[model samples]
Target: MTAMPPSSPDEPLQPQRFFAVVPAAGVGKRMGADRPKQYLVLRGRTLIEHTLERLCGFTPIERVIVALAAEDPYREGIAILNSSRVLCCEGGAERCHTVHSALNSLAGIAADSDWVLVHDVARPCVRVEDLQRLLDRLQGHPVGGLLGVPVWDTMKRTASDDQVIGTVDRQHLWRAYTPQMFRYGVLRDALSAVLARGELVTDEAAAIEAAGLKPLLVEGAQDNIKVTRPEDLALAEFYMAQQEAGQS
Candidate 1:
């Protein structure tokens, strides 16, 4: 599943425009909340609202494309989506589907070589400095990459019966995080191929790997956590407060 190169060596390099895609279609049943976990309020704002505002505040990103569920009623209250920098499209049932749909929605506007950053809507604590670092580190890269942190804890492989099968190596293992950046054409094609094969990819980097390419890992702060369970809301709130206090 090797992807064809977008450009040959003879062609002059072109400036790649940065665009963001956020998959906000999931119901997040694990949280056991009345509504989608993204709609859950944190520090007086919904999770999606904070996430979108952080991305929108990043000046390098030209546009932020948000993929919402077809019948999403919560987005209407989010005023930031009305900004010229934001665009909305109907999302699919899964994260991969939503991302692929979002990419398809950008067909006319995005060039093949332009950068598309796919971020999670639950991770509202992504830092602006880390965003800039990702772009800087991946500049002129052959295949794009994502922000991640190395696994420091002891790893274990457990069986279905909750028995420890083996102690896995923690080395060379990392926790993948967003926004996973890749070329517009490469990512779109990768996700399309995976979906066509009826394969589910946990992240854009995994899809890129399936396409026979290695995505670089840029070390980022651990504070950029994705809010999944009910307790994560408090952690995210604390992280945000810490970030703000540090700046102040």
Candidate 2:
């Protein structure tokens, strides 16, 4: 990866024309894997490698910057992925913080209007069709967007004591997934606001919301599940197989 000259803080931010940011620093405790879920083997390669493989296929994306855990325990994973045009950065304790760290690495090159699609590295089955779906939807809107699937299963709510409370109204519910697309400086400002308010957000869109901007939710697949647990690995493998077979 070539070093990007930092942008001048005082200069007007230019519209971004290239690049994507990926956050891959989680410890993967829920995955029950000794290695980070992103580095875990999938279909013959690590999950992150597969994720980058899909992203690298997109001609619109010029470069990919991965936000990883400091000390980067997955040396083999890194070496395998090094051939791709992807750079690495250290992540923070929290998910959004990791994205912020990746954004900071952009220096002056990232502009408020330039697009940055922040995705979860653990999810290796992200489809090119789904990404195209998002780009098409965002092209018609001012604010950027992300991938989301509507709730299709039965809903349930639990009580504090672990008793069944009632069925949650699933009417307006939608499952949030990556890649959450947005502009660079816009996201930076939104994150800064969240930090100042001492509030936490579950995703980049939430921060964008606090900034009074509404990001478009392009329909995505439920098949794009985050590999957070051991059982999920199998499901992810199946999903990825379908994707590979062009079943998506």
Candidate with top lDDT is: 1
Q: Can you give the lDDT of residue 73 in candidate 1?
A: 82
Which sections of candidate 2 miss by over 4 Å? 1-16, 80-84
Deviation (Å) of 2 in candidate 1: 4.9
TM-scores of all candidate predictions against the true structure: 0.95, 0.88
Model 2, global lDDT: 0.79
In the predicted model 1, the residue pairs found to clash are none
Error of 1 at 137 (Å): 0.9
Tens-digit lDDT track for model 1 on 114-193? 89999999999999989999999988877799999999999999999999999999989999999899989889999999
- List lDDT for all candidates, in order: 0.92, 0.79
Candidate 2 clash pair list? 7-108, 16-114
Global CA lDDT computed for model 1: 0.92
lDDT of 2 at 58: 83
